[model samples]
Target: MQLILPLILFLVGFGAYEFFETRRAAYKIAHRIHVNGTRGKSSVTRLIGSGLRESGFQTLTKVTGTYPKLVMEDGTEEEIYRRTKANIIEQARMLRYAADRQVDAIVFECMAVQPQFQWIVEHQMVRSTVGVITNTRLDHLGEMGNSLEDITRALCNTIPFNGVVFTSEQKMFPLMEKIAKKRGTQLIYADPETVTDEDLRGFRYVEHRDNVALALAVCQHLGIPREKAMAGLHQTVPDSGALEVFDVDYIPYKRIRFANGFAANDPESTILVYNLVLERFDNGGKRIIVLTIRDDRLERAEQLAEAIVQHMPCDYVLLVGDSTDRVHDVLTALNFPRQQAISMGVASGEEVFEMVLDLTDDRSIVLGIGNMVGKYKSGTQIVNYFRHRSHITPKLEEETRA
Candidate 1:
């Protein structure tokens, strides 16, 4: 009985100390932006930071998507290696890091999945002046909820008190607005249509218009000129896992075009990128879709399979990773041709590389989607294999044959 009192008091003291420390660190950084959403959080965070730095602010940014990285004011980023697993307490540490550097602004992608942690990250740790939600999509429904309304309500938990919020989510704007009103925050909806083709052409790599629009809205709200902000955005380094395409000549007269869309895990984002790739690439080529499954994400695998079956048209569907059986089952139930669906279960990067070479011919386009990194192969590893194989020119092939 006596030990309980001391334990309770000790915990209370620790909590109080953490709270004050977080507040002190937050006070040192003037402009703090918390980016939270179903998708594009990392891209928007990077864009906003780049835009601010272009406007001459010493900015610090952190992203928890694709991979965790701490971006410095000089545009250099260092991978954040965690001794333990992911924890929301990292945000408090990030606040101290920003304060130590004496940065003018800090932009952070919200890392927490739980509702309480999200609220704590916003109200206690970051206390951001500007909040951005890229969109409300059906993702992490297990943590948030099953319905879109529930997802929106959960995402709105981070709306700053008496601050401003921005989003590209048109369907849930009313819910966001109501939350902003309750919190005394102003909500701004960024229309994706406002970002024209010319504006998109400015980006070095393929990027979604919605993400660009949300980032532009936030930068403009912060008093940055659209032109200057875009200039900085153009210079921003894309995340290593960002969607990209590469062309490879594997042998004489045979070529393969690879589009890396593994980072877009959700069905909606995956389908959107699939359509975009179809529009951008050569229509005459044989289209192949590679879906990598994760054992931990069975629901994701099933959802992606359904999305592909319903919307995406392809000559072949190659399945990889631990959860290939679940995907194969889904495809079978849908009456997809057994021959058209190839399950390369638990294959290494090299094996997958050979399989792709065998499946594709001259004028073939391969779209790699689903999880970026898997147990047997990583997206980077597969991409590298194709790149290295492509280097075997006609002359090299002839030399080998001779």
Candidate 2:
């Protein structure tokens, strides 16, 4: 009992010191923008960071996406190697890194999924002066919640105290506003209409208008001119997992179009991207959807299977990763033609690519969705295979990796 008392006191003192140090680190930066949401958190974080840097602010950005990366002030990125599983404690490192650089601003993609951690990350660790929630979508249901409303509420836990919050979420703007008001913050809607098609043409890769608009809103609020911000955003480097379609010319077969949508973890975003691919490339070709599953993410695979069966129009559904047969069963039960669902259980990326080629004749549009990277289970290998074989220019090859 006597030893426990001293241990408790020591712990309390250590925590107080950490809290003070973290807050001091955060205060050293002129701008602290914390980005959260179901989708596009990494993209938005990168966009804001690039815009700030272009506007002459020494900015640092961190994105916890397909991989954790620390984008430095000069736009060079350093991969953050994780010694263990991801934790909110990593935010402390980000704060220290920013403070050491004496950055003018720091943009962080919120890595917390649990509700309590989300609140603590914002209220305690980051204490961002500006907050951005890309959009609310049905994702991470097991952690956030089942309903979209629940996800929105979980995301709102990142709303800063007495700071402006920005979002492109139309359905739940009111709810976010209510939460922001209680926190003495204002919620601003980032209307996508304001972002012109001309503005999107500057991007070298596929970028959503909603994401661009939201980033623009935050940059504008930071006193950057729209023209300047757009210019910076144009030059912004895409996340390594950003949507990119590559055209591969097989020696024996005709050209194959590979759309890397593996980073779209949620079904809704995947559906939207699939539809966009269909619209963009009207070439008559076999359409294939590769759904990569994880042993731990069977539920997500099931959700994606339903979305693919109901919404996406494709000739073949190639199931990869762990428990593919289970997802194939789910697909069949959803009325997806059994013959069309091919379960490539835990196949190597080369094996999957070979099967995709075997199924296609002349022209084929293949969309790789689901997990980007997993334990010995990743869609990136398949993507890399296509990327190596594709006729994409050296510049494109460089950009995609960035």
Candidate 3:
């Protein structure tokens, strides 16, 4: 009886998945576009969706950012999944749902986890009208083969034969260019830098420039007017937790928050954020760095800690996660101030925040970073709370109007 019941449940799940797959495949044939990259997939997807809407197109976006946010044509936001591994069947299922609702186009972000999945999901399942590859960076050391060749091959496999590829100049750009040409898909660069300061309302970060360029290039190809496309650029805001800074006054000191989640996906990114850390907060008083290294990527743990110490003069360090002791040792060994480093092992995000809060006086800058959002799924909310509290408005309305 136990065996029979288990088999029945398995059959039910399989059948449901198969149903979703078929429906999703049909939806793809109807309105298909695929965007894949190491970073900027979520931001670029959101930017593209917003741009399309400003141009009066019906759009549905399946976002696989640090979290899952699905944006419908009416600009409604729905929380889709809380757990990770948003599989190919699920990606297809979103298309099916979009088709039912009559969304004009479907924008999907491809997961580069098992790089080969890129080809199968995009080519065989939903083949795209427009394909995008952001930039190739060094992250994901465990699942992906160690060599850049392996990473590039897995990513390049998604070049669409029938669609255009809007990509950035990357280390593997030449190879990607070669593949796109061979497939006869026109390939172009997506440089955020192309969008001038006048187009964006307020202050801008360097990262958003390429994303803007990419979306504009793709939107223009679809025959959206270049002027309308340029106008939509005014509404752009930094993706949540991206390296944006805000100013707020709370008692003895004003707070500065660096939204670095976009810059936190990999060790090199983390190092870059730290470099920015040094550059921005030079001689800033009472610096408190609240950071967590994912238990999964312990390989980068030591280097990250060492990098933090080498780059920033963090007055006090609050470490979060199971690998705290190991990461702490790297800094302590370098004489990086043993008395200042504190660990919040296996603590909740709020708890970690409180620990930092207790340590923070009026004159401190709190830099919360690392691959926490992707790993913990709660990163954006926690980071968002800080942004909301410290003058970074949730809506980009004011800035857009500026």
Please, what is the whole-model Cα lDDT of each candidate in the order they appear?
Answer: 0.85, 0.88, 0.68
Error of 1 at 366 (Å): 1.0
Say which prediction, candidate 2 or candidate 3, comes out ahead on lDDT.
2
TM-scores of all predicted structures: 0.94, 0.96, 0.81
lDDT of 2 by residue, 1-402 (tens): 989999999999999999999999988988999999988899999999999999999999999988899999889999998899999989997898889989899999999999999999999989999999998999888898889889999999999888899999999999999999998999999999999978887888888899999999999998999999999999889887888878777865686888889888788888988887777753579999988889988888898999998899889999988998999999988989999999988887788889888998898889999998998646878888888888875654544333
Q: lDDT by residue for model 1 over 84-166, one digit each (tens)?
A: 98998899988998999999999999999888899999998999999999998898889999999999999998999999999
10 residues in a row with least lDDT, candidate 3: 393-402
Tens-digit lDDT track for model 3 on 11-122?
9999888766764655544456688877677777877877787788788877776556788787778878745556776766676677677767877778547767777777
Any idea what lDDT model 2 has? 0.88
Error of 1 at 94 (Å): 0.8
**Candidate 1 regions with alpha-carbon error over 4 angstroms:** 1-4, 374-377, 387-402
Candidate 2 — worst ten consecutive residues by lDDT sum?
A: 393-402
Which stretches of candidate 2 lie above 4 Å from their native place?
393-402
- Cα error, residue 127 of model 1, in Å, equals 0.9
